[model samples]
Target: MDYNLMREFADSWGLLAMALFFVGCVAFALRPGGRRQADEAARIPLKDD
Candidate 1:
């Protein structure tokens, strides 16, 4: 493929793909009951075992 074609595809589709992925991650993080899991993970370093 030519450089111009590849660059055009990446400039549009690549940006859309990255934006969707970021939104999905934010949704997952903010979902119900996520807070408890996040808190437990935060305390992992303090655990002895």
Candidate 2:
């Protein structure tokens, strides 16, 4: 509950958690077969209902 403890947790675990999340997102975006889904999503706004 103290500032020092919170700061240390943020500097260590928080950084690790954020890094892992970013890497997971990058992996998902770059994975095989994702291009087709991405292209479809990109054209959603231009599609008529």
Candidate 3:
């Protein structure tokens, strides 16, 4: 296995940004407000085609 490359990849800013984004998404999904908003949006009908 390429330990050096893997280490570099994991340590890069892009990976950190993605990880933070993933965590934020998970947190948002688990929030009551988020769930409620999603549910309400799903039930809403579009006014126009």
Candidate 4:
């Protein structure tokens, strides 16, 4: 197995970029405003009538 090549690829930029994106997503999801927005959106699809 070429472990070195795999490590190099991850260390280049893709892994860091993905990590930053994931963190941003998590932060946004955890925010109070995000939670409220999600709750409201969820209810919009439900059958109320």
All candidates' lDDT scores?
A: 0.99, 1.00, 0.84, 0.87
Residues 1-49, model 3: lDDT tens digits: 6998878877897688899999999998998788789977887795354
Candidate 3 off by > 4 Å: 1-11, 46-49
> What are the runs in model 2 whose C-alpha is more than 4 Å off?
none
Deviation from native of the Cα of residue 40 in model 3, angstroms = 0.4
TM-scores, each model vs. reference: 0.92, 0.96, 0.57, 0.64
Best by lDDT: 2
| Pairs clashing within candidate 2 | none
Please report the candidate that would top TM-score against the real structure.
2
In model 3, the number of clashes is 0
How large is the C-alpha RMSD of every model relative to the true structure?
Answer: 0.7, 0.5, 4.9, 3.5
**lDDT value, residue 13 of candidate 3:** 74
Question: What TM-score should be assigned to candidate 2?
Answer: 0.96
Kindly list the per-residue Cα lDDT of model 1 for residues 1-49, writing each as its tens digit.
9999999999999999999999999999999999999999999999999
In candidate 1, position 15 carries an lDDT of: 95
lDDT of 4 at 34: 88
In candidate 3 the C-alpha lDDT for residue 14 amounts to: 66
